[model samples]
Target: MLTIPKELPAGFEAYGRSTDFTPDNLPARLQAAHSTKAGTWGLLHVLEGKILYQLEAPFEGEQLAAAGEKIVIESEVPHRVKFVERGRFFVEFYRKAELTPG
Candidate 1:
């Protein structure tokens, strides 16, 4: 069974986001197994249609996310995505917020 975190860990903040992508425009790198850098997390938001998310070794499994749904990617976890139907989506990255002395 695939387990997705219900939310990002506390103290993490959004750092960046990817351009909206459709199946035709999805990057090659995202279609193959890849992982986020240490301390980084990713939220894959589906805007339209459906997508297949596959988690590689150590957490091997797959889940399908549809429009209005999202998938949380844990830091350093190997995973990949593909179109289950024509879809539009974007990935928002997050990392621990840096402490600032006030």
Candidate 2:
């Protein structure tokens, strides 16, 4: 049950960035991700094992996000270390400036 975000507003496109932290020494695919600093928004999905989502500071929140579950967050938010997972996961970055008014 993979859930993807709805389409962005007019003139906005999904900008994606991906990095594989799966190790060569291990049989598991483990990766961790942090959002971009350019005032972007993103969604992270775990295509294999489970993941943990953590928020820093006054946010004081944490959740055990699972495979096929998508988490959305703003880049500028104080939250950090959003996800730590094992297996395939990808992120798509979005920004308000990318959207053009009709």
Measured by lDDT, the strongest candidate is 1
After superposition, candidate 1 runs with Cα above 4 Å error: none
In candidate 1 the C-alpha lDDT for residue 59 amounts to: 86
Residue 78 C-alpha lDDT in model 1: 91
**Largest TM-score belongs to which candidate?**
1
For model 1, the local distance difference test gives 0.91
lDDT of 1 by residue, 2-85 (tens): 576878999999989999999788999999999999999999999999999899877877779999999889899899999999
List TM-score per model, in order.
0.92, 0.59
Runs of candidate 2 exceeding 4 Å displacement: 1-12, 21-35, 80-85, 97-102
Kindly list the per-residue Cα lDDT of model 2 for residues 1-102, writing each as its tens digit: 222233443444566666632323222322233335765777665666655655554455555666776666555544443235455556666766543588
